[model samples]
Target: MITYIEELTDQEREAIREAIQLLYRQTYLLERRYDRRTEKYQYTKEYRTCSTHLEFLKDYFAVAGISLEENVHDGIIYIQGETLWGEKLPRLATVYLLILKLIYDEQMAQAASSTRIVATAGEINQKAGAFRVIKSIPSPTEMRRTIALLKKYQIVEPLDILEELNENTRMIIYPTVNLVLSGDHIRELLESFSEEENSGEETAIQNTIEDLSE
Candidate 1:
């Protein structure tokens, strides 16, 4: 529960709004599954629009020296350009990673390979904490961005799994996206980030002073 919000300029808030909107959109578009037994979807079902999620993002970012501000038209949000908290959208990334973790857990339980199962994004969101899954899964664009970020940090990598097709002209193969996570490594990264975030208040104060002077 870190709170990163502070007053922000129109320009900075707009950037934040756009980024969060992108995140919500991307998370919503991920592939998912349906459980006939439950008569409903399993992964993520539905989530708030970008604006709704902004409330939480603003709080999270505020703890890290980044505040959100709305544009004059109130159609956009702005954020500090710097990586105020060392990581961007930490909550969102953590949520996506948690989804991957859940998928891994399910695979292990079923004794199936990653490529052998189909998971719906809806299910993931449902199981996630409100703080994490503010909105449903991200859209494709957001997923791509998340993937890029994960790859950039080497926190996760695309895993290749073998798929097979039967000769009966029936589809028998599941094309699941593979995810790899080194818990120890990821834990270390989070710990370091937490440490950095502890000093976010000081940073925000300094940034505010700079803003005023400018």
Candidate 2:
């Protein structure tokens, strides 16, 4: 390992440093991965760095319990660390993550391709409604705050400004959302949410009735 690290040229070493930092910070590298759009715009030269040295990165990160995953088919390069902060995600964010995954899976089932899954804020809200999860959608400010948390991990990326959000406010829901939470786990959350939503609605209705009686 020492010999291999020594063999790396200054440029290669720099690329490794940037890639490691990117994965450590973002958890997923989408814009950095090679894709059709990456080629069309002819992005900055940093984007041109080939993944030929990825194997070295994999071996190196393993020392720190991080696994560098490269999926050309999915057009993503991400890392999975043993001590990742998956358990710290808030329940609200988890529900949103599951909803996004459900949306992505539904879309993928209908059409299979490398193309990104686009979901509008309305669509996510609708899906949450359909699943009978999240008794009430929080105010846009609170909702965006929750989403911003997931955004830090590169789970759901916004395509437009927060002001433009509505039924038509589209965002690219990354596959990493699924990686963070497994398929079976999401299904379980759905069932749990169903019960919670029902209870919450019943309580709200009873409170309203009591107010009317007074």
Candidate 3:
């Protein structure tokens, strides 16, 4: 039996437990292997090793039906797939959902363990097979055009995905999830905008952003 007595966040501990519960049967039990040569009791969980944990996350996304791709601009993980809400989710929104669900919420915020990653184009290509086959993966040029259109029109306000970085940095970070017209609250927001807003720029921008991003 491998034992690891360490300070873990509630979520972190739960993730490990889940990994053990879910993956142990297919994979081996995650042993806290002791290096007899060094005589040190390892504190980290071990199942199988890979070049990057993101590779494992790549598999994880596959289990969830979101195809992850690489972005040339920032080299972070990109997603192309259907939305969890049944509406078509854009690559940005898909990625945001995966990050929110699997990585940030389940793995980071909930799980105590830290599995670090920085996404790349090559790995994304290997992992994003489904999206590519489905023609959902957008080219780099398309991504740029969509972002620019969104900014110009005001369909969605860009939140700082990379808060500390200057605007010159191409790192785009913001909630990609937008309220569609069918949403009640979104209708209210649109009504409010129509009443007070002088610029039709917002409407034009929103539609263009959705068209291009999707």
Candidate 4:
């Protein structure tokens, strides 16, 4: 690996280093991320860097028992492993994630071309109320913090200032939502909520966040 890297140009080496650090921080890197300022998707340089050094990255992450994978069809690159470092999401964040996954699925089913989906803060609250996932709507401060956390990990991107988030504020739900929880897991959790509702009980969704980091 050293010999191969030594043969690369200085710029390539620096890019590879940056790519490594980026993966460590975010776990997943999309080839194209939504740019609110441009109102379009733009190619990510880190993704290109990772693609250029795929083999080296695979070998490097292997030492830590993390498996680096790329989905060309979806333009996503991610790492997964039991040894991965992760964050313990707050209950509200976990609930929001579940709602986002549902929204993504619903949008994808109706989408004709683009996979990029958009949703509003009001819509999220509506879903939460419909599902009875939480007893009441989250305060603006709670919503801001939750969105910021998910944005940091590339799960969602705000279309407006987070501080001013309200029912009408918009956000771009990234495809990375699919990686956060499998379809089966999502169904299971939703079913559990349904059963609890039927039984006149409340249940909180439990997530270890083992697959998400930083």
Candidate 5:
């Protein structure tokens, strides 16, 4: 990896460095992403850079005890490792994530033609309530923080100004959500929720912001 980087032009080397930083910060790089400004999907330069130098990037992350995995079919590249300590999300944020994953799954199951799945905050809250995940809707402040957190992790992107966010506010749920929580994990969580409801015992859901440094 070092020799490969050394052989690159200065500009190329800089691009690689920037791409590495982006991956470290966002955890995932998609070949294409939703462009809020245009309301369309567009190819990502960072993803192209990463793809062009996959071997070097893998070696670069591997040295830090991180493993980089890519899904060509999904056009996603994400990193994972025990060394990547993640922030524990607040209960409300965790609930929102679960709801978003469920929404994504349902939409994909319908054979939606677009890779980008759009949903509204109202739908998220409704599903949370319908699934009995929360006793009441989260406060705007909590919702704002949750959205910001999810946005930072590249899980969801708000379509409108964040300050104006409300039940009707729409957002794009990124495919990265699938990598974060697998189908089996979602089923396990739902089953746990069911058990909690039956026992009437509040259990803290274990959810962490992945592929991030502490």
Candidate 6:
């Protein structure tokens, strides 16, 4: 593994180092080159570098009991390992994630015939409101932060940032959102939400990362 890593130029080595740091920090890496909606960037080249030196990554992560995974089809790379309940998303982020997963699933199932699901900020707000996942549309600042967080996690892609936080602002919620919440988890969440709706105990909620054992 060291042999391969040592063969790379200093710049390539730095790029790989940065990529690994990012993966460890966010646990997800999405190659912009793979996204048809975005232009190419240095990330894809760096991603290839890591891919070429995959053995190094595997060996490095194995010590920590983390698995380095890549899906060429999805254009995403991620590190999967143990997760603590306390390490999970805050209530607001978790709620938004669930809502986006639901939207992605619904869109894929219909006659749309497209794997990609495009939704406007207003549509998300309306659907989330209808499901009572949130009391109201998140404030612009809050949504901006949430979107940033999601983008970092390879969950969503926003085409334009100039006119963000508005009703017409469109974003592409990736299929990775589905990975965050398994089908069973989604069912459990919906069931829990429904019971809360009847019982008026919206405050009671489950932690997503609680079940992940590292």
**Model 4 per-residue lDDT tens digits across residues 1-214:** 8898999999998998888888876677888878878988899999999988898899989998999999898888998887665555666777788889888988988999766688999999888777776778889999999899888778888999887778999999988877776554554565355323423322222224322221
**Per-residue error (Å), model 5, residue 145:** 2.0
TM-score of 1: 0.27
* Cα displacement (Å) at residue 118, model 3: 24
Mark the 10 consecutive residues where model 6 has the least summed lDDT. Answer: 198-207
TM-score of 4: 0.83
Each prediction's whole-model lDDT (CA): 0.39, 0.61, 0.32, 0.77, 0.75, 0.65
Q: Is candidate 3 or 6 superior in lDDT?
A: 6
Backbone collisions counted per model: 31, 0, 8, 0, 0, 1
In lDDT terms, how accurate is model 2? Answer: 0.61
Clashes of 5: 0
How far off is residue 153 in model 5, in Å? 1.2
lDDT of 2 by residue, 91-209 (tens): 56656776888888888888866566778888887778777776676578767776677666667767766664556766778766555554444555565666344342321100111
Instruction: Name every residue pair that clashes in candidate 5.
Output: none
lDDT of candidate 6 over 70-104, digit per residue (tens) = 87776667777765112345555666676787788
Per residue, candidate 5 scores C-alpha lDDT tens digits across 1-214 of 6688789999888888888888776567877767778988789888988899998888888898999889988889888876664455666766677778888988998974756688999999888787777777888888889898888777888888779988999999988788666654563565355324434322122125221111
Off by over 4 Å in 3: 1-51, 84-208, 211-214
- Compare the candidates by lDDT and give the number of the best one: 4
lDDT of 1 by residue, 1-214 (tens): 2233346656655665655554332211112333345644344222223344567776766776666654422123345535532233344555555455555556657874434333444444454534333434455555556554543433333322112211111111111212123242332333233322433232121122122112
Off by over 4 Å in 2: 3-14, 31-50, 194-214
Indicate the residue-level lDDT of 111 in model 4: 91
Model 3, span 1-214: residue lDDT tens: 1133145456655664554343322221222323334644343332222112335545655776765444332222333345332223344433222222222222234445633222222233333332331134445554444444433222222333323323232322222222222122322232233212332232221112233222
Q: Which ten residues in a row have the lowest lDDT in candidate 1?
A: 165-174
Decide which is better by TM-score, 3 or 6: 6
Worst 10 residues of 2 by lDDT: 204-213
- Give residue 60's error in model 2 in angstroms: 0.8
> Following a full C-alpha superposition, what root-mean-square deviation does model 1 have from the true structure?
18.0
